[model samples]
Target chain A: MKMEALVHLVSAIYVVSVLLGTHGPVYGRLVSVNDKPDPKNAAATARWLVSQNSWGVLNTISSELGGAPFGNVVSFSDGEPGKGSGIPYFYLTTLDPTARNALKDHRASLTISEYPIGTCGKVDPENPTCAKITLTGKLKVANGGPKEEIFAKNALFSKHPEMKDWPKDHNFEFFKLDIEDIFLIDWFGGPKPLTVDQYLQAKL
Target chain B: MKMEALVHLVSAIYVVSVLLGTHGPVYGRLVSVNDKPDPKNAAATARWLVSQNSWGVLNTISSELGGAPFGNVVSFSDGEPGKGSGIPYFYLTTLDPTARNALKDHRASLTISEYPIGTCGKVDPENPTCAKITLTGKLKVANGGPKEEIFAKNALFSKHPEMKDWPKDHNFEFFKLDIEDIFLIDWFGGPKPLTVDQYLQAKL
Candidate 1:
């Protein structure tokens, strides 16, 4: 009986530790860039990459160039972070050919953000908090290998199950991004950049 | 004098036509990419590039992960559609090195969204509605050039004169991004991936 009790306590502590240790969603900013990749900045670069690929609310201005309103909640993803086997990857899905073409050109960036549900105000569109991390990076169609494709598909489906029934080639395509920078903004202040490693550490 | 008046009327008409025609903003969706730049899908690539260089709000989800929130405006100067001389660029200033590093690696894939006022929700920390378009692209640190540095300075100072007094190269740096893709979402659900040209034609 004592042994069983001890086992339960250990298990509980382990679970709590894991939960506490793993960082929640972190806000980041994209500040500067280098023409080529630098190993010395690997930690920062990695954190930005993860943040960019992660999910958040995406916004755009009106088309009339006048008083058009902003849009909300588009899906996005950043892959799992780590070295060697499981590096994080991110992607988005759109039916527009222009967007498709742009993604193919490796010209895409993202602002991954998180809010305390009520931070943005009421869930209504009229008044809401628009706090998030904007990650600037390039977008490329995921065309690596069967294994890579599988991983991409799984990652996407995990986030958005509604996409499961879509045609394999149609709504589904892998988008890999090299995180160039991150821009983090809280409603309290202004937007700024964050390093990839810092973002990752925040997540952890 | 009558002939001069006629000329003035013609010129006024032309000016009004241009204002009415080119007054609005463009919208579209960006493509996705990974580490290497993919050349196969040029259109998607372009959209992605536009998205990467854009700006948005930032939010924090956890404390363990050094998450901070901020809000800032980013400006872009892609040539006026027809003029091919200008590429898109924006201004970013932050004291965070992590954010700066992220912008450097994946400069190609970022998103910048633009929109009119009231398009976004109110500035309520809970509910907000601000409309704008986003672009994703690569970031380049300005190194005192006629074209690069000048453009960056002009855009930043024009919109944000408050920063004019900021120290040079301390916490502020002029950065230029080569847009790869762009995503413009009006939220009216008219059509996806609206081109800048198409948007102009619609106004006419």
Candidate 2:
């Protein structure tokens, strides 16, 4: 009887931990399963995304706690399709006091798109096409703490060696966009989109 | 005769000063002119490019020198279409040592593209469009300069009032991508491209 009681206590602890963990209410939005993305199209899109460099808009926004605002750029991955570990993701980093405060206070939305004239590869000038996506989610600083922070930091450093020597104490925080909804305008056709849940459930 | 010689000497000094003070190479690569851009397609492309909000990719270069070698979603504008100033432009306010150093050592290249998946809005998901434009230009610290710097500071501040109180001594530099060339697919079909010179010359 004591062993069973202990087992029940342990199960309760596990449930409570999950409820209060990083992936709890902060990630409350539900994502529907995505249809199997077309392989050829997905590969092409992934290639184009990964082949380029540079992203971000320099802007200032009001802080959540109220005060002076700050300026920063939100970034993301173009996800290399067919590349198992290359799923696309978005992030927010700022030195702006207001933006940082707001990020900590509420969910943020990120809109992504291509430069009008193109910046990395050959954009078909005559049939020039562009894409835009909006991701709504919350931001959570991912530096320090357990293995997750270490892994994220290493991954960011490996991809951006130039930032290897950035000052350590500066409030340089990295936050991941736990994407909830993804709305896209595939100029080739419809305006349908895939949710994060659908995306995760789809067999890529 | 003395007066003439003095005039000539003064003229020589003026020319020398102008030449030395210019920030770019004395002789830029001559670009060939091309036919007018197809109006219908150009407008379509322009609209598409303008509608994008975010993107992701790796910027594998120095940020201080100007190689913002990281992936971040940047806000950009399509400058007035015909005039060079009206072309698409990206604004970056970075204090990264590497990017700053790179900007000082070499002109920067900005590569950007749409993310893959149905989410980030790829034009032809199957042929994800992208572009690479080399901003081979100079960097200017936007402070305590002559009329141009003052005007620029005011203009930028007005556009971004939130940054009015940022430290004035920060290495606040404006890096302009005097776009030398653009490689784009899906713009003019898939084969041909529009060079910066061509676009400028064909400007309506």
Candidate 3:
């Protein structure tokens, strides 16, 4: 092989690495299943989505746009990878509208997809078989005791080490979704009917 | 290089290539920039975000949540990759809450992040250095005539070819965000000041 051709091949290999190797599994929460969950196993599937994803879209009532529903890309953690508590937690600041909106109206939702986990194979992201989840309920600031705070901090910091060093002036605080409803679509039958209790009690 | 080591290295390269080799260029919209857009070029940066990203969280007022803001994972197109019109378009159906929500209320926002673009490198997704854009405005069904439908259909089908074969029973139709305000954070100074006119008029 010519030296120039070899260099081009090496560069192509490196770019591919950058694209595919970027899903940071700071913890072992990401599960690579050979197949998606059965449509009937709604709770287990919902739990899997929440635990595996490091970030999701947090929704809130936009106080600025005459009460428009606002969504923002935010990093979150449910637990320490496989040991998730089935509750999504976030580190947020009021500088962003999401946190501010949540404070005024706790009604919110968190949406996540299985595509980024790399287990969906060749299917398009919108495919029903690929799986998508939305946890809808109240978004509340964590007023839990020191133990709860520690849990939230450790879960978030494990997946996102950079969070610990975010600007102190931003007044970043821990928040959790007080989920009242769960909408999980893992197969062809539309959203699997799931309850909050089943989700929290499921053993993944 | 020893033959044994070379074989392993070659295999690793092949796997990485398979992982990153998926996003085909419908156009040159997928700019793998060596560096991010300068914060000063607000319109250019915002347009770049819309064109480069194939998916984002589409937000709308949730009629079920009693007028709360809702966000859903969605795939979208601005144009054929690089040929984007600075206007985000989506193929949606009433089977999904996003399209249903929009039908009830047009106020919405589309949020995209630079983390997925692979340009942020080692920077965390939540880090300020990583760019995130929120295009706030009305999410309207495109009834601009058959010309608009053809444009949207072509643009979307080019990126997500599977959409062309999505279930006809789902009744998917074209929807576009009539952008009113832009909030983009590419640097530490906070959301850059950008206008709708500036975003659509910027020369990419």
Candidate 4:
């Protein structure tokens, strides 16, 4: 190989090694630091949090616990890794309270933290600079027809490869939060003034 | 140093390096794998999750959003590292929605995931085997007295050193989740059959 090509090859290997080294053990995909939007950009940052994270706390009003807010750790996908739609989709089973509760009362929220993305560095997870977004809306089955189901499956299975082999009897189906409100805290002031339309329309 | 002592020193360094290599960037503390309780021990597992995790999604019925379940990422501590009290505590300010919501209606839950502890390995975060816990109950201020506040401050600041320096004008105060119910999923069957009493009594 030419000297220039050899240097490029070594640099490529170094980059790949760093990515793998820092990748969340469960989320074995790349979350490029370069792709992260600036904290000042509310809409873009919100979209980035939803798009980059593999799992978040999916909250629903519990039927079992007297309508108390119930939050469960869940894996979600907006789209294939980089091509996210900013609308988080979840694979849930009715056996779990989150799904059953959503079925009865669709009021729910999906909270994603930038802390897990490794970009927060030494910042405390609760620190405003770390960034967190909560998309509050109705959680319901993705009954958008066979086309949407196929898209949901592809989106989930692409990022979480293990989901494709999960027990068939569990009856895991795609559910999504129909975002009505967006609460993002990327900087010190407080929740950013972002709209659902702004979040979905942000270029990720 | 003696040759045997030198060998021991090198081994210790190797172990420390491995531990730091896997520590979450935001949670700059050690969570030993050996300290993890057995999956079959419901109460023990619940306490372990509460103790080991430095942060979780604190859910509240949003007062602003017309009672939608709002989940926000927040840092918490049950006690100092390896000495947890089974009940999680937080340093929150009413300036944020979660604390404000909690003040209006105390019903809340704190959802914690074992994935961030770096113990789940290659298992998908949503998988039951990865372990997740939701402590549901009232979220109220720690008005147990000055003694309790001191304990809360120590529990928080020890794990999250930076929290001690967070803006004092924000009026951050100690808040504890008065766990009325424990929903723990450490293994495949379903939510563990563990009660609040069983969880609090478990030796950590």
Candidate 5:
């Protein structure tokens, strides 16, 4: 094959392999890019990270642990698959300290790493180039009536089907991070100066 | 071939495939288990998590964000390779808020999820069967003798080789979570009742 044709064939095979990997359902959703957005496009890169991940560390102030910062592993969704709104919605129960902590003090942050997305390749998770975002804001329970609840549920259940069957007795309720500050590190130098508005408005 | 013989052959092939998959140096290090320990072994399970994971969300009280719990994606190690002491060590610099926060309050937590280990199978990350651990306590800079620094560096560099090459001008120093509490959920009715003593004493 000609060099140009060979390059096209290789790229096609790579895309096909990634698509095949996404069949796992619970993880491995295809982002808009086969790789990732350029670090300079802060909003797009941040949105892509949130859209592609299914779980992250949700931080809350712990009343039980003498008001210490507590981080918990929780599954989250920005929206149903590719239609991410960039506002992470979570299903949390008061039984867990994270939700309980949030009820008392709304100040929280959700930290998501690109490592688990399988796009960081061999880079260290702490490496600035690997990309990490901490969306700091209020952790508010969804009390915006039935319409909002429906949207949150659809957004969550579409990605995590098992969440729908979590014991009803647990009283799991919808919660969201009302993003106020965005701290994103995608490359060397320092955090990209991104606003909540830019992140929410970014075309993913 | 006999049915038992065929089953054994398949199992061997499965093990070989997992070993082959672990060739990626940065992310895919082989843990002690071909499968995770029984969830009933809380101490053992927690130790396994700390030993196996190289990175997790390190939470700290952010002075900049009005004492909000700030969780950052960071790489860590408990000890050198198979000799994990179950006391998580870190390489941090004051340029990062996490280290500065630790210097002020010393309260922190490190949360690790088993989902990334690839041994969770198809289980949802939030599911109790998939396992998660949070070590809550003081985040102290390693002020011990030169021997302690060497131990911490060896522990970190063995698991994260690239960490050794991180810029010297960054002024990275060793730190460890002086764990006072242990929270683990493997196959849980709730958080496992493992104590720090049990976690530190458990044999990996």
Candidate 6:
């Protein structure tokens, strides 16, 4: 095949491979991208990191541990599939200290890394270019009304199907961060200057 | 080959493939493991998560962000390859908020997930059985003596080779979490009760 045609064929195959790798209901619905975003676009890049990542470390002030900042691994979603709203919602059980801690202090943060998405490749996780976002805010149980609960359920179950099958005895409740600050590091200089307004307004 | 020999051959091939995937000098040197420890061995399990993971979300009280628990993705090492001391050390630069946060407030935690180690298989990241560890303690700059710095260098550079070459202008320094509390979940029920003494004394 000619060079130009060969390049096109390779690109098509790559796209097909990605589609084939993403399987099951949870992986099937969401959009997955490995492209590194331009560091200049702080809001877009920040939202992109949050939307693309499936899980992150949820930080909470542990009253039981003498007020230490305790981070726990968790699966989260901003919305269902490609329709991310730039606000992360989680399904947590009080059995977990994260939920217990939040119940007491409410101060928390969710940190997501771009390295897991295969976009960073060889960059060190600590490297600023690898991209990490910490959404700092108040952690609270979602509104009990059907309107918000339904949205939270769809947002979580659509991305993490296993969560739906989790034992009902766990008393899993929907929790969300009332984002008060955004700290996003996507490039070398420092953390990106992103605000809650800019992040929520960014077009996916 | 006999049937038994063929089975062994296939297993060998699988192991070799894993080694090939984890590259670079640092990754090459570390003894990687994916087997989940028994929930009963809370201390060992906690140490295993720290030893096996090269990076995790380091949480700290962010003074700049109104004292919210700030979590940042960072590369860390507990000790040189196979000799993990159960104390997580980091190579942090003040350009990052985490290091800055630690400078002001020492209260912190390092959270790691077993999902990345490929042992959890199809389990959801947040599933209790998937295993997660949160070492809550004080984040402090390492002692400025040659003895400690050398150990920190060897431990860090051995697992994350790129760190040795990080820009000097960035002023990356060695830091370690003074683990005071251990919260580990390797199976169902809830967080395992593990003390700092138990974790530090656990046999690998």
| DockQ (CA atoms), all models | 0.02, 0.02, 0.42, 0.43, 0.47, 0.43
Kindly report the fnat of each predicted structure, to 2 decimals: 0.01, 0.01, 0.47, 0.75, 0.70, 0.68
TM-score of chain B of each: 0.44, 0.45, 0.86, 0.87, 0.88, 0.87
Error of 5 at A147 (Å): 1.7
lDDT of 3 by residue, B1-204 (tens): 454555466556544544455433323333456535676788888888888878888888788876766778888889985698999999999988889989888999998887666576566677767788988899999999999999999899998888988889989999999987787888887788888998899977
What count of clashes does model 1 give? 160
The sequence of per-residue lDDT tens digits that candidate 4 reaches over residues B77-189 is: 99987789988899999888999999999999999999888678677898888999999999999999998998999899988988879988999999999999988999989
The alpha-carbon deviation from the true structure for residue A66 of candidate 2, after best TM-score superposition, in angstroms, is: 9.2
Candidate RMSDs in order = 20.0, 25.5, 4.9, 6.0, 4.5, 4.8
lDDT-best of 2 and 3: 3
> After aligning candidate 2 to the native by TM-score, how far in Å is the CA of B189 from where it should be?
43
Model 1 residue runs over 4 Å out of place are A1-73, A79-98, A101-104, A115-131, A168-171, A186-193, A201-203, B1-204
Task: Estimate the lDDT of model 2.
Answer: 0.34
Best by lDDT: 5
Clashes of each: 160, 68, 2, 0, 0, 0
Residue B113 in candidate 6 has what lDDT? 90
Model 2 residue B180 CA deviation (Å) reads 31
- Angstrom error of the Cα, residue A140, model 5: value is 1.1
lDDT string for model 1 (A14-98, tens) is 3443344321222121112332123234344334433333334332222222211122334444542222121334344455432
Candidate 4 segments whose C-alpha is farther than 4 A from its true place: A1-29, B1-29
Interface RMSD of 3: 4.6
Per-model TM values vs. the true structure:
0.35, 0.36, 0.87, 0.89, 0.90, 0.87
The TM-score, computed over Cα atoms with residue i paired to residue i, of candidate 5 is: 0.90
Q: Evaluate candidate 4 and give its CAPRI docking class based on DockQ.
A: acceptable
Top TM-score prediction, candidate number? 5
